[model samples]
Structure formats: structure tokens, C-alpha cells
Target chain A: AQTVTQSQPEMSVQEAETVTLSCTYDTSENNYYLFWYKQPPSRQMILVIRQEAYKQQNATENRFSVNFQKAAKSFSLKISDSQLGDTAMYFCAFMKRGGAQKLVFGQGTRLTINP
Target chain B: SQTIHQWPATLVQPVGSPLSLECTVEGTSNPNLYWYRQAAGRGLQLLFYSVGIGQISSEVPQNLSASRPQDRQFILSSKKLLLSDSGFYLCAWGVGGGEQYFGPGTRLTVT
Candidate 1:
């Protein structure tokens, strides 16, 4: 069984400020994938970014990036030049490379961008 | 491009009533489908997943059941609803070893 943990339950930051959301997971599988998803007030789940365990380089998508430490079993999300729209509930997810493609998610972190 | 759809955008049902949430995908064939529930202020919990028609895998034991009647249609159902079942339900579609795309989701309120 795999479990993802998001230590921070809630976070608030000023608009345009950078913020990092921490995430850690417990897994025995060697090959897997990590993902960060954002759910805005509209209640739509959107994929922010993803990182493969085999890859040493981190994944970056415009303003969002990840610091993936495979040995430490940690995958953190960084939002640079954050905007008000970035205010949302962020979740970290884990999935094995193959099989049923089931995703195990963390409890989530509620982020608010203040103006 | 692939897209997923889930409906009645919002649902209000009384306890002991039945449930039937439908999900469909467009622009993809034989794609993997999944059902997830998100509790208030919580992350997503994967309830069921199907790799093909008539193949359903349940991740948790609960009052719900899922069925894939067609290649692009997936349904989540329950004979009787419970208060604990009230939450946002999300439907997603994905190909092999790729990221899954989510629908707008259904907000279910069991009163």
C-alpha cells in the first residue's frame, strides 16, 4: 500500500509571492509517478504538473515546478510569481508506473493568495 | 484531444434514495476510466477504475458500485444513499502510463 502526506493543512501568501507546498510519500515500488493537482473554487480538478521517478530532472510548467527527491520520497510543488488564481486546494498524488494506474492522494493543502 | 464529462452538475438526494452518476469520454477509444470522491476540504479518494468495458476494480469497500457498460461510458451507483456519501464526485480518463484528465465533477448532497 502507498500513502501520501501533506504536512501543511493550510497556507496563505501575498499575491506575486512565491510559495512552496511540501509533500512526502511512503512507497516500496521503485518505478512510479508523482503529480500535483489543483482544485479551484469551481471545484474542478486540474493537473498542475507531474514527475516520473526515473527522471532525475524536475518537472516545470510555466509558473509551477516540483522538487522531486526520489531517495527522500519527497515531491514538493513550487509556485513562482503566484497569482490570485493560484489560490486553491493543492494535492500530491502517487501512482505506480504500471498496473491499474490507481492514484493515491494526500490530504491536500488549502492555499490562499492575499492581495 | 480527449475530454471527459460528468453530470448533473449538482445533485441533491434524500437518504435511502438510489444514486446513478454517469461519466462519458470523447475523442478516445478504450481509455481507462476512474471514479473518485472528494470529501469537504479533503483530497481525492479513488473509488473505482476500469481498464476496459465490463472490467471494474474497486479500491475501497463502500456503499457504491461502478459499471462500464460501454468503452466510453462509466457509471457509479448505489442502491441506497448515505449521509457519508455526500461529496464531490470526479470522473477521469487516461491512456497507458499518462496523466489522467478530469471532468468538471458532480457535487452530490445526500440530505
Candidate 2:
């Protein structure tokens, strides 16, 4: 079974500053996928970014980037120029290819961007 | 463009009452549908998933059950609601190996 772990329970960043949320997972499959999702007070889960296990180049989306270390089983999310709107509960997820393709998620990190 | 819809947006039911939450997806076919629950101030726990019509896979043994009558519609039901079942229920659709798109979610309060 694959399990994602988000070590940081809560993180705070100043507006326009940068913050990184750490996540690690346990999996045996070589080819898989990792994702970061953001859930605001609105309760809508939004995709922040994703990284394929076969890709070494980190995935970047606007102000969000991920540092994916496959060997270490660590995928961390970095937020640049953070804004108040960025405050939300961030989750790390893992998905295996070719099988049931179930998505396993982390406990989550509560991010607070202070103005 | 693909969109997922879940209703009712918010529901309040008494303990031991029946529960029925409906989720539907548009702009796609034969999609993989999922049902997840998020407790207050907590992360998401996947409750059920369906690969196609009439196929349902449960992640954990709980008080809830799920069904897929149509290709794009996934339903979560419980004969008797428990207080612990009170949480925000989310519906998502995905293609294999792609990021799953989530719906606005349904807030269920079981008193």
C-alpha cells in the first residue's frame, strides 16, 4: 500500500515571501505520479501541481513549484510570492499507474499566508 | 473541458437518518469517479471509487456505501447515518494517469 506523509502540520509565510511544504511517501512502484492539492475555506480541492515519476525536471505552475526526489521518495511544494489568497490546506497525493489507480493522500499541511 | 458536480451543496440530517449524495461529471465519458470525505480541519479520505458503470470499490469498511448506476454518475449512500459521518463529501473524476478534478463538494452534517 502507498502512503503519503506531510511532516509539517502547519506553515506560515509572509506576503511576497516564499514557503515550502514537505511531503514524503512510501511506494514500491517505479512508474507512478505525485500531486499537490489545495483546499481553501470554500471546500473546493484545487490541483496545485503534479510530477511524473519518470520526469526528473520539476514541475512549475506560475508561483508554485515542486522539488521531486524520486529516490528519496520526497516531493515538496514551494510557493513563491505568496499571497493571502494562497492560504489553504495543502495535501500531497500519490497515484500508481496501470492498476486500480487509487490515489493515496497525505494528512495535509495548513498554510497561512500573512499580509 | 470537464466538470464534476455534487449536490446538495449542504445537507443536515439527524442520526440514524438515511443519506444520499449524488455526483455527476460532464464533458467526458467512461471516467473514473471517486468519493472522498474530509472531516473538520482534516485531510481527505477516499471512501469509494468506480471505474465504470455498476463497478464500485470501497477503500475502508465504514458506515457508508457507494453505487454507480450510470457512466458518469456516482452516488454515496447510507442506510443509517452516524454522527461520525458528518463531514464534507467531495466528488472527483479523472482519466488514468492524470490529475483528478474535484467538485465543489457537499457539506454533510449528521446531528
Which candidate gets the maximum TM-score versus the true structure? 1
Docking quality category of candidate 2 according to DockQ thresholds? medium
Runs with alpha carbons beyond 4 Å of true place in candidate 1? none
For residue B6, model 1's alpha carbon misses the true position, in angstroms, by 0.6
Give the Å shift of residue B31 in candidate 1.
0.8
How would the docking of model 1 be graded? Answer: high
lDDT of 1: 0.95
Report the number of the highest-lDDT candidate: 1
Error of 2 at A35 (Å): 0.3
Q: DockQ of each candidate's interface versus the true one?
A: 0.84, 0.75
Give per-residue CA lDDT, model 1, range B42-104, as digits (tens).
Answer: 889999999999999998999999999999999999999999999999999988866888999
- Interface C-alpha root-mean-square deviation, candidates in order: 0.8, 1.1
Measured with C-alpha atoms, the lDDT of residue B103 in candidate 1 is 95
lDDT by residue for model 2 (A23-87), tens: 99999999999999999989799999989999999999999999999999999999999999999
Query: Which window of ten consecutive residues has the lowest lDDT sum in model 1 chain B?
Result: B92-101
